[model samples]
Target: MFGPRHPLMLIAVLLIAAAPAPHRPRRIVSLNLCADHFLIPLADRGQIAALTRFARDPEISAEAARAAHYPVSRGTAEELLALRPDLVITSPWRRAAIAELLRGRGVAIADVPDAQDYAGIRANIATVAALVGHPDRGTALIARMDAQLDALGPARGHGRTAAYWQRRGFLTGAGTLVDDLLRRAGLANLATRLGRPALSRLSLEELVANPPDFLFAEAGPVRDQGTELLTHPAVLRAVPPRRRLHIPGALIACATPAYPRAVANIAAQLLAADRIPTRARSQ
Candidate 1:
């Protein structure tokens, strides 16, 4: 029993003021797709308030299966406020307006940066983990990713070039996650060699005139005009089916824990291509 103004009471008050603030956000909401990727694996399931609707779509999200279990928000202010999120994780690249709106209302925001390479990936993971009050979990996830990459061994591209040819002839260029992934597999990005920007479209004729050793096509059914172009006769002739590696759209959709999976898949595909005859391989 100490009096209110006692020296011991005063010291206790000062100590309490100096203590670190708790960072455990119990009601976290994710507005960015990339944020959704990291949130699903790092944050406790109970800590999550909601994820974006895209989080449940397997075609875009690597953690779609797990994210499916969480509630989803369309990112509308009303919807987000109703969830009473202690932390809102989002990207400044997209949904800046929504994030700004939320901020004006006094919501705490964690702006997740765009990860263009593996180092960025590690940083993003760490940032999200710490935000969720689980820095150890972030470190562990990064360690696991590093270990898996080491076990996977060296790059297997063998100086070959490839183009991440997307629907409608769009080529993924330098400084992008796709380009970094290509380098990891020992392959060079044709877009960089051509002096193309981060995202640009190459016509069918240009593709035929300067075809790379391989075409990194998106894996999925042809569902529309965009996807239809991927399977056009011109594309098949420029880079034969045998020389094409159809990676899952979800894998490259974002830089997340699934990055290792994408790397492994690329390396495996390149290894398989090695066993083929030089003439057929070039075809």
Candidate 2:
């Protein structure tokens, strides 16, 4: 039989083992723009360790002004570790190495899924809410969103039956989020008839030759570039001037809570372009 250790020594070892881990984190860091939006509102100002630098750019984040006061980093693992965050919230699309490094250092990592539709967006809001111990807030947010969506009313049927969306020659086809938004706004996407996926590239010549009743063009920053694409000299010469509307590219990119606003804007723009004088055009 082995000799017994001293009672004092054994007691000291047990006490040390029972002590809570010192490396556990109490601060949270956000690594993406969407996560920033979800987490910032849920977390206390003191609890937020850092946010990505891009979080301050209004072009990418609508809550930039509110986020400007927080500590910001370039989304590198080294920078994240320097902040000593207990938890890191990031998009699923973040680099694997950053996640691995944080995990290796015993930091909790929450990889939020990309919300591609209305349901997915609601689920994502709940997920973020749970992380910040504010599930009730998530429910409230969802309720508000539901109310907004419900107020949209049934899809109207007065608009042109077929429409083409030209975004730098890429068309939004059936089954895509943009297509869903268009359908919700009471416009038919012509891309589906062409038997294409979410997006398909079509030449300006082809578009002019077989133009749909309505054209929604996504104009970029430069008016000249958009003018060249929409009013291409060849296209201007060939196709008769019909109804053309410009939709800012940002509105159609992300499936966020602001999507309903985007849908409303697009619907209003379409109604204006269609010259539909009915009061129903006041979306």
Instruction: Give the number of the best model, judged by lDDT.
Output: 1
Give per-model TM-scores.
Answer: 0.86, 0.75
Candidate 2, residues 246-272, lDDT tens digits: the string is 555445445556667766676676555
* Clash pairs, model 2 backbone: 25-86
lDDT of each: 0.88, 0.68
lDDT by residue for model 1 (5-82), tens: 689888999999998864888899888988998988799999999999999999988888988789998988789879
Q: Which ten residues in a row are the worst by lDDT in model 1?
A: 93-102
Off by over 4 Å in 1: 1-22, 93-106, 220-228, 278-283
Regions more than 4 Å wrong, model 2: 1-26, 156-167, 220-227, 234-242, 274-283
| Residue 145, model 2: Cα distance from true site in angstroms | 1.2
- Colliding residue pairs in candidate 1: none
